[model samples]
Target: MLIKVCLNGGRLRRDHPAVPLTPAELAADAAACVAVGAGAVHMHPRDADGNETLAPTEIAAAVAAVRAACPGTPVGVSTGVWISDGDPDARWHTVSTWGSLPAADRPDFASVNVGEPGFTALAELLLELGVAVEPGVWSTDDAEHLAESGVAARCLRILVEIIGVPADLAPSLAERILTRLDDLGVEGERLLHGEEAATWPMVEMAARLGLATRIGLEDTVSGPGGVNVPNNSALVRLAARMGA
Candidate 1:
């Protein structure tokens, strides 16, 4: 179990204006997150346009900065279909672009959302490239499909996301994930995260289950105390408190 933080999600600039987009700002946030005990860090590489891109240069630059800032921390990037100008084979292009990146600046891992067209291909590509894979399961069928698809057997870790849902239902989502893991008869690294207010409960449940967790503006625009968090480290530190 490893606690990670997602630095930026989407449109967070105005919601929590302190969210970092520049490489220097991202570097500072990574350093602070690692200092506070988060073992892994996640982020989307956004250019000056504030749109996520999977281009080799964008991924390379951001990865280099974060690695330099937090030498030993595992760096993972988002490979979501939501990325702007995402290709019909976007997963292939985006992930292969990451795979071909320089070793020193290459991402340690990258997330592949389940229940999508390019899901299995991205998983295989990541495995073949030797980049750790973190598969995010947002629904019961996603977990079931992964189990049957045989990707789960090779996944480096699992990140169960219950986005846009209520907090009270999160524990149930956690329960189902555990059950799905059992049903599949496969167990590996796992973490819980969600969108907005329910994000807190998901983290709490992660702590209670002694499993890994993630927090950041990507998941919630508001701070833990409902004040806007200046940076991702603020959310990481708060998640640490739950486990502390």
Candidate 2:
């Protein structure tokens, strides 16, 4: 199974001391996670203030640094609307600037949430920019939306991201979304993951289903036993032990 390490999401230093917020820090964390069995990297590039940003410079620096640290390991970034204050147009503009980045500095792929406004346009732009699009499907509705949009077939993979659900219920929720995608003929590689309380359960579920899964401070701050995890590498190590 492919276990991608999400170095950070919108997390701050207050959330975890080890959350990598700088280009060098992200590089170090990516190297450590890859050493511990993480096969790929997903991260949210942050500005100097530690807030997520879609700025081309920040994105280029983050992607370049991580790729340097873990050569040949795929590196991906988030295009979540929250980074653009929920303004799809602003997000589009920032992402459009990524085309100016040199090929080596650009992300290998980027996650674009299907539920967000202008998701289709964002995905199209990323495709045109020579970046693979990973469609993030948060619910059955998003799965149906992805299927209807005809973009699922072009995505690097579908991210079955289960968030805001209880751990016990998350696996079943993920199942429903997966079933919906399957029924709609949305077939390809699928990566399953969850946030907060649902993280570990979904990780185990993904392993059981033989699907790709991800882990890191982006998904949770704790290990499978609910203990506070020290860093992204620790989470990847534990997930690796679980056969992720």
Candidate 3:
């Protein structure tokens, strides 16, 4: 199973002392997680002011650093709509700038949320740049959107991401999303994951179902049994122990 360590999302230094924001910090944290058995890495590249950015320079810096730290591990970044404040046109413009970056400095793959505006166009752009696209399906509706959008078959994988739900309900919600995808004949590799309160349950569920799952400060700051985690490596270690 592929256990990707999400280094950080829109998290800030106040969210966790070890929340990696700078390129060097992301590189160090990614190396640590990879050393502990994380098969891949996903992170939101941050600007100098500690905010998520889709700028090519910032993305290149983060991707290149992580690649140097963990030579063969796959590195992915978020093309979240919020980075551009929901302006699809601006997001596309900024991402288009990435074409100027050397291949080595580009993300191996990028997570494009299907529910976001202009997601298909963005995914198409990523493909044009030779980057694999991992479509993020946060709900059954998102799954349906992905199916209807005609990009499911071409994607590197489908991210069945469940968020804003209670732990007790996560697995069933995930099942519903999976079932929806299956019913729609959305054939492709799928990575199941949940955020915040639902993180570990989804991890265990993913392990039980033999699917890829991810964990890190971006998903939760607490470990199983609600213990506070010290860093991304610690979360990866615990997930590894759980057979993720």
Candidate 4:
């Protein structure tokens, strides 16, 4: 089972002082997380002023730095709608241009929420660029749509995002989505995770089931036993211990 650490999402430094926002910070944090048993990392590239950006230069810088810091570890990025003003066409264009980067600067994979508009186009671009796609399904509607889109079979894996739901309810919801994917013959790694309050609960559940899981400040600021964690590495280490 793999444990991916989401080094940073669209969060600012103020969201968590240790959230890595620059290439250097990301490299350092990624290295530490890997050393503590993380098999992969997911991060957001930032601009000169630390705002999240999909610009090739920024993406290259972040990807290169992290790879240098943690050799052989896969690093992925988010391709959320916020990156393109909620315009699917614009998002597609941005992702299309990512293929122009030199080999070493490209991410190993990228997460594309199938629920978003034009996800099929974006996923196609990533495949054309040799970047693996992680189909993200945040709701039952998204899962049903993904099964119908025929994209799940081509994706590197599936991201089961359990958001806004209480911990007690997340498992059943996650299982329903998983069952739907199963019925559709979507077979591969299925990463089950939840946001905020449900994060650790789902992580523990994933571990018990021997399924892959993830943890980082992006998913939750809390650590084992509900204590606030100090950084991405700490969160990863605590999750590793839990899974072990």
Candidate 5:
């Protein structure tokens, strides 16, 4: 199973002291995670004010830095709806512009949330640019929706993101999602993860399911047994050990 590390999301330093916000911080943290057994890297690029942005320059810098640090490892970015204030056209414009970037500055793939506004068009645009897409599903409905959209086969993989739940409930949530996907004939690699309290449990469940999983400060701030994890690399190490 592939163990990817999400370096950071839209989280601020207050969320986690070690969350990598800038390019240099991301590159160094990415290198550490890779060394500890991360198979890929996923991150959200931030602008000068430390806010998440889909600006080409920010994306280019973050991708370039992580590539330099981790070499051949796959690096992805989030195309979440928050980036465009729920405007599908704005999201399309931002991602379309990213396609124009020089190859060295582009992400290997990007995660597109299935329930978000303009998801289908954004996935189509990414495919048109030759960049891979990871369809992100947050619920069973999302899984059903992605299956019906006819773009499942075009993606690099499916990302089952568990959210807004207690840690103990994540496993059932994941099982329901996978079952729904199975029922709909959605076949391909699936990566599962969760946020905050649900993070480590979901990763552990994904491991037991023999599917790919991910971890990082973006996913959780705690380690195994709910210990406070110090950095992204530590989270990767925890997930790697769990997988083993």
Candidate 6:
């Protein structure tokens, strides 16, 4: 099992200027996260504009930067449809229409936002290209779909995103998520990340359950304890204690 922390990069600048977006900044942050016990990380690479992008050039730079600093820690990136809408395809073109880039330019793992048009096709392409899939099962309904479709076998990892209005009421949501995964017969290792302030609760739940967990600025800028988190490493340190 692996504990993954997110270095949201550019997205964090607006919400928290301290979030590192440049490769140099990312290298430093990656080292910090690894030191605190995160064996994996999810990243969002940004261009000079400070917006999300997965362009192979940017991807290679970001991946290389993280690896240079963190050594063997696994790196994952977003292929989210919302990245730019592509062209005439709008919401559908994202992963499907993205022009090809070599494997070295790609992250080891990428997400399949379940139900996103062309996501399954992208997953197939990613698999063929030697990239691992980390499907993002956002809601309970998404998990149920995976259960029925035997989708777990198609990916390298499963990322259960605890999302809701009130959101991630701790072990309550975590227990519910786990039970659903159980029902689905999801046998492999999985990680949990929550939307907004829900991130900490999911980490706590994962710790109690002895499952791999996650933390990130994308999930919450605040500390798990409600203090202002200076960086992702701070979040990882807090989460690691739970596992200890």
Q: Give RMSD to native, each candidate.
A: 1.7, 0.8, 0.8, 1.0, 1.0, 2.7
- In model 5, what lDDT does residue 143 have? 88
- Candidate 3 Cα outliers beyond 4 Å, as residue runs: none
Give the lowest summed-lDDT range of ten residues in model 6: 88-97
What residue pairs are clashing in model 6? none
Give a tens-digit lDDT track for model 4, residues 1-244.
6899998887777788999999999999999999999999999889988788888899999999999999999999999988878988888888788878997889999999988999888888899898999999888788888878867788998999898998889999888988888877778889988988889888988899888998998888788567878899899888888789
Model 4 misplaced stretches (Cα beyond 4 Å)? none
Candidate 5 has a TM-score of 0.97
Stretches > 4 Å off in candidate 2: none
Model 1: runs farther than 4 Å from truth?
84-88, 225-227
- Report the poorest 10 consecutive residues by lDDT, candidate 3: 235-244
What's the C-alpha lDDT at position 5 in model 6?
80
Q: What lDDT would candidate 5 get against the real structure?
A: 0.90
Off by over 4 Å in 5: none
Question: lDDT (0-100) at residue 10 of candidate 4?
Answer: 78
lDDT of 1 by residue, 92-168 (tens): 86567766666887788889888667788878887887777889898888888778778887887888898777777
Question: What local lDDT does model 5 show for residue 97?
Answer: 94
Clashes of 3: 0
The models' CA-based lDDT, in order, is: 0.81, 0.93, 0.93, 0.89, 0.90, 0.73
Candidate 6 residue-wise lDDT, 197-223, digit = tens: 677777777777678877777777887
Model 5: per-residue Cα lDDT at residue 20: 93
Predict model 2's lDDT versus the native.
0.93
Clashes of each: 0, 0, 0, 0, 0, 0
Candidate 3 per-residue C-alpha lDDT over 42-151 given as tens digits, one digit per residue, 9 for 90 to 100: 99999888889999999999999999999999999999999999899999999999999999999999999999999999999999998999999999999999999987
Residue 200, candidate 2: alpha-carbon lDDT: 92
